[model samples]
Target: MRLPRSRRRSETRDVASDKSEATSQTSLPGDQQAAGAARRFLRTALAQWSDSGLPEAARLGERLLDDSTLLVSELVTNAVVHAGTTVELVCRLDTRESPPGLVVEVSDHHPTRALRDDSGVLDESDVPDDSREGGRGLQLVAALSDAWGISYRRDRKTVWCRFDLPAGDGATPLLSLRGEPPAELIAPVPPQADRANDQEWAGRGALSFLAEASDLLAGQLDEDNVASLAAQLLVPRIADWCAVWVYPAGAGARLPSVWHVEERRIDGLRSVLEKSPPAADKRPGARHIAWPATPGDTVGGGALAVPLLVTGRCQGTLLLGRAGPLGLPDEVTGLVEDFARRVALAMGAARQYARQAMISTVLQRGLLPPAVGRIPGIDHAVVYEPLAGDWVGGDFYDLFPAGDGRWCFALGDVCGNGPEAASLAGVARPVLRLLAREGYGVCDVLDRLNKALADEAAAALTGGTAAWEGGQARFLSLLYGEITPYAPERGAHCTLASAGHPLPLVLGSDGRVREAASPQILLGISETAQYTSESFDLSSGDSLLCVTDGVTERRRGQRQFDDDDGLATVFGDCTGLGAAGIAERIRHAVHAYDSAPPADDLAVLVLQAR
Candidate 1:
């Protein structure tokens, strides 16, 4: 029954007493018959190896023979099914180990195709629960092979496996979680005769695998991404398939990611796994049991499910499934646990960031007014924008009636951005409204707000358990104004003060622009500072323009939007534009000043006489 390397080996070597290592290779056409030819080839190899004690092949030849032929059948079937090209299979007795190892390589011409998904259905989408797939062949290979991996050359792709033909049966490869495993695990070493060289190959493959897994998992900042990465990282590389489950107490469990080695069966696998969520295991070693948490597996259930533990908490569970009752080797199970720890850490970090962002969003919503109030007899417009990616920023604006004959408006910018500056702005806006409605003038409101901010800051700095010690802003630039209109068609009486804010500009109907308020010290600087209000007549067809530093300080290399009186020049050009027209024109001009977006928060307001 022996087939030659070229069908030309002498029949003398096939005798029962032959001790030389039996090795042969063959090329089969890319067709369904390839698997049968491969199985027949394995039968002949085992028959010739009957005399040699390569490992325990002589004593346990019958068991090894059955497993090896099945392994060959599965590997060659996959090549014919997916690659659909000529298959080059090599079967050899590699004598580099304690006894010796049987190395089988099944290669095909197609190399770059994606590893087939067995279920074909992926993710959490609905799929038939009992749907079948063409992955059992791989399941058989997974159950039987000691160590296996895929390799690629320019001309073909090869699936290779090594069988440590069981020595003495005293404690075998299908070891307990604490038992020792073989040394050379999937290392890329050439066949040789030195036993010490086999030991050198041990650990390198595992270290490289974990290092690459870390590189991919470390940069992920989202919980779902952590789950997805962890599942995919285990598949094909370590496990035949994997699923990641993240659940919290009092919350519904989520199956975020699933992957399988065969390119087709992803959906069927996901459906089966979904029906039986693994119990939350907080143990040190992987719980070797059926893992869809199901009663039994059609593909011979042997899975390791363990909690993803970090900081004494279980963020999720990771399940790695193999083909047979033989779970992962002892070393690999430890590796899986270590991998779970990193995934747990990443998930925890992502969740923390999400909570902060949500809180910031709610706080930001409370700090700003719902809508700008309408002003009587004054054509007014307001522009407000925050820096991108910031939930809350330093800049704030408001336009509201003070419940009398006068309407008040304010715009301010704190020293810095984020929750701290947002808190300051949040406090200042409500206080200004309260003071103005109580009959305080524009300058009076500024004075009171300045005292409140400085006092609060001082208290926080001097006390333990202070809320704003690390996050408080040191300064705020503000512009406060009050408008009283006599007639709908006439100019209004305006009183305003600038607290280290941009100077308000009045653009005349005659094309002349002039400053309406003078500069003063910023609030939160001095509690004893007295402020003054400037009064000016806003005549018909004249526009008043106000903005924060985000507008005036917008930069283009060495030049700013307001450099060399640039803002004034831009305002002067808007001769007779209405409130909204002037506000939009100036906004456009500021943005056009540079090709890049503004680096700070922007706010603009404009008012024109009827």
Candidate 2:
């Protein structure tokens, strides 16, 4: 939506110096002399505003009057030559809180006849050329004033112009829909070419101040600093007061807080505080939210409040104020919002940097546990790689002893990724290790894990209750195992229990490879789930290779499969390789399986029975 028009005069010919002191005079007695006097008064007022210390007021004055003074001259000229009647001009400074500005009116005692403004020939087409000279009086008046029209009383009709000048430094005039000047009054003595030069010079002086304002905002994202610069710029452009405020901190949907304040006096803020704060929903963020001044408040000013938000979070607000109640234009409001966004991004970056550092510290401490304690006839090695980028892969390995002179270990993939998924792994990993040591069998270990995951999953679902749908809810995919070993020279045996985990690959002395497909049920689904154990015979020089899906599922181009047979064939065909050799072969095969690095996190564990 568009900003509303200002209601006071900015460029009046005889605007009073002390707005506090009211003036009642309008026109001088005679026609020719009065037109000349009006022109002179306008030139003087324009000069004073340009030279005055109150740049904000001067800016408002310049905006209100520049084109308007010319229109007044054209109107007066028309009354003298065409109306054949003396016109009475009355200028009043309407400083009311609602329609605060200057009003200029011209009245004549000719009620029987309407004022006909026909200073131009209507062509086949209605467009007017710049070269046209005779008919342009009423056109000029409508072009300048925020609103201009004629009203008739019983005996006379008054032609009046109302200019909205709230802060004394109002923005550029928004042209009317017709795109034509309203009215014109011709002077008996015309302005020479050199006189036009003087007006140009005056216009340049006014523009220079606005240029200063642009320069001040060019290199900074600080809203407070920009407001101060805007106030200073307004002063040199016109004689007026300036004020600014910031969006308050901790404002909610019910009410918003003010951030920064820049004003000529404390009374300006007091005036605003007396009125209700703007509705938060109407002007969500970084868009101007304006409020009218209180009825009896000591201040009369215009305000523009813009919120600063980035990534859906509010940073702050920028509020600018003037001495009267006028709102900012959309263009100006957009510029302020852009500045606010830049500031918000800088702040967000700083916060993200600190958070990343903290995450890194905790992850480092959670790296794989040191090599498991020695078992006389066995040698082992383990490797883990965390998935890169934002995703946190939940691959974990554990090794602990079962009381029956057997050692147990498990490698599993907990479904999902990132901090929350990592958090679930963080809880499940250590708990499983403790449970194994506490004599819980494979099924019992999974039963306890499911209980823990149930609570964790519920919290996740509840936290996103607004966004949750049945299809989008989270679940985990996990695998667990326990192994018991015996003396290999005596053709000893090992018993294996699995919880939906990948089968261990066995390489025999006869140059043959096979997988021990143990019966299994995935962990963390239900408490009553059961898993059976599988037993296998072993001898010296035999190797057991257990790994996560990240290894066998490695992809080259689009093809991906669990290459269990290929890996077993390689180990059995090579022959005579120990635990370390088997581990090295698996790692090499993975690197070669993909022309590029594997997409998921990879884990590998190898054991040899001597």
List TM-scores for all candidates, in order. Answer: 0.62, 0.42
lDDT of each: 0.71, 0.53
Relative to the true structure, candidate 1 reaches a TM of 0.62
Off by over 4 Å in 1: 1-202, 205-212, 248-250, 291-298, 457-468, 471-473, 489-491, 573-585, 588-592, 595-597
Report RMSD for candidate 2. 23.1
lDDT of 1 by residue, 423-540 (tens): 7789889988999999988878998888887787677667753435445556789999988886888888889999999999998889999999989999988889888889999888
lDDT of 2: 0.53
Task: Summing lDDT over every window of 10 consecutive residues in candidate 1, give the lowest-scoring window.
Answer: 175-184
Residue 325 in candidate 2 has what lDDT? 47
All models, RMSD in angstroms: 19.0, 23.1
